[model samples]
Target: MRAAVFDRFGPPEVLHVVHVPDPRPGPGEVRVRVLAAGVQPFDVAVRAGEMPWAKIQFPQTLGQEYAGLIDAVGEGVDDFVPGDPVLGSTMLNGAAELLCVAAENVVRKPAALDFPTAAALVAASQTASGSLLELGVGEGDVLLMHAAAGSVGTVATQLARRAGATVIGTASLRNHDRLRRQGAIPVTYGQDLIQDVRDLGLQPTAALDAAGGEAIAQSVELGIPLDRIGTIVDDKAAADHGTRVVRAGRDPKRLAAVIDLAARGEVVIPVQPFPLDEIVEAHRTVESRHSDGKVVLLIAS
Candidate 1:
């Protein structure tokens, strides 16, 4: 099996694909023939050695989310069978040709959603859903989202809208129309962010920060309470400003709910795709932090 790996992390160019021994599922696990994977900021940080907590070894595999078809199931696994279409979270092995994850963690993929899009939704969905829930966002609340054009931002905006909250998101001027179409009021980033939202006459009762920088401080200046301000990208900022650090843990059920809505076409995710062989480019794309929706890698069968 071939997989993306890095011996000594430094840059996207350091990533490359190499053939490794095929893996078999252990008890209570299922082995999947990966069809697509999502490259995330976390993967970029890991590759650059920015995340000291990540357990990296020489030639370590990269990736956290994938969509694939089940090829085998180990003992005690009864939820999935060969040919079952699924998508889920994995640990640093998602960019490979095959993955073995516990059957309990797998989220069944609807036939309506393609493999790459399903892969894109795995990590972002859980994070968005959990963050909204923790922040108590609901009807009658106006939410201010920093980096609203991002993957998690896109998903969060749609979900918050459905929950009856109005969304005001920060992004580049080019993404303003895209945000408006997603039911959000678009605001640009930087010094005017607070003034931009203020001009809308909508008071932000809650906020989600997926983009770092002064998002936390800006959210504070916008009059959103420290408790209602959540930062997924910067714990330091959250702590410094007395804001909530949204620790949305991985949850298959949370992922399934949003995915089901996506399958029914109630929510939308635009995809930026690259082939698996272009792993270096995919990593660079994620690192660029400019692509809307999710950056996906199409893993060929």
Candidate 2:
């Protein structure tokens, strides 16, 4: 099997495909023939040796989310059979031709969602859903979402809207229309962000910061209670501002619910795709942090 791996952390150029022994599922696990994998900021950080706690071995594969079809199931795994199309989060080997993951973690993919889209939704769906849940966002609340055009923000905005909250999202003028279509009142992010939201005449009852930097500070200035301001990015800023750091941990159930919404077209995740061999370019795109949607590696079928 071939997988994208890096021997030494540096940049996207360090990542390359290499042949490795194929993995077989252990008990309670299933081996999936990966069709697509989502490239994330985390992957780029790991590649750059910026994540202090991440254990990086030479030839380490760096991906967290993937969509694929089951080819084999190990003992004690009965719910999924061969040919089951599924998507889920994996620890580090998602950007590979084949990967083994716990059967319990995989969500059955609906036919309506393609592999790339399903892969794209795995992390963002869970993160967005959990952030909203942790912040207790609901009807009658106006939510301020930073980086609303990005992957996690995109999902968060839609989910918040579904929960009856009015969302004001921060993005460039180019993405304002896209944010509007996703049910968010779009505002530009920067020094005047707080005033911009004020100009809209909607006070943010809560805020979700998917973009780091000054997001936490801006949310604080919006008069939202510190407890109501949650950030998935910028832990330092959250701590400094007394805002909550919502570590939206991976939950298959939460991921599945959002996936269902996506399947039904109630939510959508736009995907930018590159073939698996172009893994370097995929990582580069994610690192650029300018992609309009999730970046996915389209592995060969």
Top candidate by lDDT: 2
lDDT of 1 at 24: 94
lDDT of 2: 0.93
lDDT of 2 at 240: 89
lDDT of 2 by residue, 112-185 (tens): 99999999999999999999999999999999999999999999999999999999999988999999999999
For residue 179, what is the lDDT in candidate 1?
A: 95
Q: Which ten residues in a row have the lowest lDDT in candidate 2?
A: 284-293
CA lDDT scores, all candidates in order: 0.92, 0.93
Q: Which lDDT tens digits does candidate 1 get at residues 1-301? A: 9998999979999988899999999999999999999999999999999999988888899989999999999999988999999999999999999999999999999999999889989988999999999999999999998888999999999999999999999999999999999999999998988888889999999999999999999999889988999989999999899999999999999999999999998878889998878999888888888776699988877
Evaluated at residue 221, the lDDT of candidate 1 is 89
Kindly give the number of clashing pairs for every candidate: 0, 0
Clashing pairs in 1: none
